[model samples]
Target: MAESQLLCMEDGLMPTAVPESRPQFYYSEQHRAALERLITGGDGAFKSLLKDENGQDFLSAREITAITSSFVKYKTDEENGGASAGQDKRDDAGSLHSTYWPQMSDTEVPPLDIGWPSSGLFKGVTRVAVHTHPPKDNGPHIKEVVRKLIQESSKVVAIVMDLLTDLQILRDLFEASKRGVPIYIVLDEPGAPHFLDMCNRLQVGARDLQNIRTRTVKGIGLNLSVGRIPGNVQSKYMLIDGDKVMFGTYSFSWSSSRMDRNMITVMSGQVVDFYDNDFRELYAISDKLDLFKQFHMTKPQTGTLSRAAVPKRPAAATSRFQVNLGDVTRGDGKVPAHKYHNPKYLLALGQIPGPTEPLQDFFNKMEPPDPETEQELENPTEELENLTPDPSPPEKKKSKKLKLSFKSKRGKKDKKSDEVIEENPANPSDEASKHTLTRDETQDSLKKKNTECMCVIA
Candidate 1:
């Protein structure tokens, strides 16, 4: 089919291509062998990642609450001597369980019961096995279960996922493809680029690509609309050989496997067909060429991909809207004086919050400093030095001169004499500074001053 025909239309929705017969879950000796393979022998890619620090996992939000509340309830019953076991105890916050998690949302919700099979919602998916992080009840690890499912699939494997960065899973899938098992993957449009990049890095050639068929969700994924907003393919599930299925919050990405506390439930029998139909529907809607086209669009080297692997914002791309003409003067683009400060004029706050009249810089500008004060302030150090009093003792005799000896260093041990003169108390800073000079320095300064005094005052 042409790639353009795959684009969802407003009126013409393509009918889903269904299998001739509903897939049958035949439990033969092969099923037991697969179970044995799952338990005993399998590839260790999943195990290799689990030991890394980034692979650490924890309980889901609701699970933590459930465990904590159960502990609290048991403790309360113990304290009441088993009398409060039958009585209801409500937590002060709201529900019977304490709010262990603040603003806690149940992202990994437990499978809800489907009205005991009579409500037309239940499917006989009884061969269920679950694995969570922390490995409860000596159950197999999450990665082990995923590896086993893919390892055991005898015929076809279809996976519809959002993200696929896990290399170990890719290796497992590659090995499965080598076993003549045709793999069909329908990925989300948003995350298609990363998966395509990974495939490039792994050196997957044309033949491998042909065997491992991959497609990305195209325009208006779930609904038709006149707007440009694209649909997000958020479904995460896998169908094994058309007869067994696995569905969960556990993403096919590394972060979901390692850092997250996600869970996957694998089932066999009647329910697999329902999920198989859903997978077929998803596969029918996805397009192979659209995946590559989007990859070229969202990749940096191929194109100008911005953060989040999307195009630059409309304002950022257009120079006209992105121009930052200041409030005082907007270059080239000038606003009429009448438009501003009038009923028609409205100032933008640069998209910042907390704008008010008192906080405006225009109304509260600082006044200019006095010119005389500005000049005086320039020589602040000299003024401060003048203001300080001399620490030396007062004169015993009726003389204004302050006599002081300063030792000077000159080649070994040569003595030097300094000239003295009458000192004015008004010029205390000059005399105070002179007190700090060494012998030779003091002598030179005093001699120069004496010569000047002798020449000018005589």
Candidate 2:
């Protein structure tokens, strides 16, 4: 199921002779067993990822909203002294429970209604927070709401990153740690090549602050998928301390802060315990450990400054439009064939390297024909026909329009027309003379020998 998380560059559009080889990756059985055991045992670490029994390692957007709202509601209720039991609960009951306590002792108390509330679970959570450093100043309400959690308690401060450095945020977090406040940093994985330099820079910051716990994303599997069915799944998220997490399109950098529109949600408590475990697992294999420890001592790689600045425009976001086997087979469990209809994406697939091709360069090489150059290549068919010989006649039925001569009119005029005339001349007298004359003489001869006219055009 974890294998389904791979991004399939092959959409079954390429020729059948060449099969696209998927990226080879190995999953740690130890990790899988650990995850399963943790969840089954109701360990706090299990909740960090917010996955189901199927191992789908993501919470939907609605789930995120619900979880944050649950924390908010619980905190609000706690403030009003109605966190658990209300004194007015008996008012709604028609029967007087106080007098019926003796009868209730003999009877079961309706088993306490073990159903999940529409409001969802709201226990073991004290605050909600959100943070982002998007390219724009939009989504202020989300930021403010998350900040409210911080103002409510000194122990809990939901840091919503409006416009700040990710490294600086971590530095401040280290300060908060000394003061005994738990902090978490959430940001996207810097996957694209364009962001590698920025990441290298932030990693320098990670190196500077030895006191603070810092991690840079090494890899994300989204590997919580079911079986080996490749499909479009999650790609962006980071959780800090189970309580402070960020999930969205933005990454941890100046570009993500100033150029991309993004969102983050922070909810603390058991939820953090759940999300934090998933994060720590991925972070363990990442280079961030080295980066955070080294800080300013390390300079950007040789090409970081030499390369051109990344354009401020958001990269063209791509979406996968997968054709599900289930839909075509109708629960038959057969792998249904699908066509890659998107021309742009299909072209991208062709460029990706399999075992034979380096996938990254293949995609990068995909170029759309320039409209101007395409127009220049367009020439009329008549011009081409005039330049080359006509197609050979069909053996069964030859074309009536087939030309007998390859040369132009002037070149073939005398020999071909004269030969035709020799075979079937308009006048026998003109044939006998054979010698051509000037205009008047030719006119007189033509008038004298005007028996018939057999010009091809006529």
Candidate 3:
């Protein structure tokens, strides 16, 4: 047999198990309606993490118990008569009540009266309007109010939370900048990076516009240095044209209006001036967020000695001893034993020399003698006699005498003449007589010689 095919399977006979899907927790229609009501109501400040994208409350079991506890507390408070019950609801309900329905302390000033009215002339009727979110059913939206404020105002000063991804609000601010309205924004230091990034993106967009003269857009970082307490600039407000002021828990962001519960109050009066003044003071003190300063660490300045006025001490004892010995040796080494039996040495330290002769007289006294110049100075008459001129003229050299002889041709009678001629070889005329005569003079002399020969021949 094949084991009877009907083997009793213990696990198969247990049960046909169907896997359970993740238990879907959703808000009821009543719960959704209540949340909307709560948001629209004065309890709009209550932050909710229960609501989903489809407007459904996906509260966990623990969250539901927390919500139930809140309802129970609300019922108890209603039975007792709300805030007038004089009971500390925060203490009674613990974290739930404290988070959802925080009790306003007596000392806490309302956001609307942040600025007090100054003592000045009330010229015109001060217009005032209060707006809260989730906004009232009949009134203007908070976003629209902000847009209108930005569009109409000549200048805007604001302090707000992190300017996150809020295109509509950022676009309105950019438009305000394009209109040449000076906008001064002060942000908490932590949110400064995000706010600066948003401003850079806005600037990049503004670059494309033609002839669009943009106004001054300045930002400042608020330094809240409190230990481990997570200090932040929690004050959210705006001052327009120093005349109108809008302030509240509201933020300049889309999530603040659409998701987060906040409030804003628009007021125009002498009171606004006070807020404007406060903003100016705060803005003046706020620091600028420079990336180079934040990241590029700098070394602390070290103190240096001044070269111009350095203190110098007197010479050392050994050097002073050597200097004194040298000074003593420069003069006579013999000690004056008669003046002092113990031979006390006289130190000339710090002593100024007494004024004696003038510099010229001293130089004259020290001048050295010149032997030749002294001799000339002592016998001036002998020098003059040596320099005088001689009276007799010099004699000239004697000239030499030369004898000349003349011989006649054989046809004529021979003649010899003895003549004595005083000749000086050194004289110019005697030197000329030794040279050859001119051709004309030679011919005339020859003719005269021939005539004399003819006479001789005749």
Best model number under TM-score: 1
* Candidate 1 local lDDT, 1-458, one digit each (tens): 22323433336775343332545422223223332232233324323343442443233556434433322111354575754423444433345644484575444322211111122344565598777875789988787788888999877778888888788888888888777688778888778888877776776544344346677785442111211223466778888766677888888877887788988888877777688667666666566633334334332232465768666443212242332344323333433332333332335423222223332463355355434323333345633432222344554334434343333433234333333444334443573564444435645674554433322110
Per-model CA lDDT versus the true structure: 0.54, 0.38, 0.48
* Tens digit per residue, CA lDDT, model 3, 378-426: 3456323322222323342122332333334445456643334342324
Residue-pair clash count for candidate 3: 0
Order the candidates by lDDT, highest first: 1, 3, 2
Give the range of the ten consecutive residues with the poorest summed lDDT in model 2: 110-119
Per-candidate clashes come to 0, 25, 0
| Reference-based TM-score of each model | 0.36, 0.26, 0.33
Angstrom error at residue 285, model 3 = 1.7
TM-score leaderboard ranking:
1, 3, 2
Winner of 2 and 3 under lDDT: 3
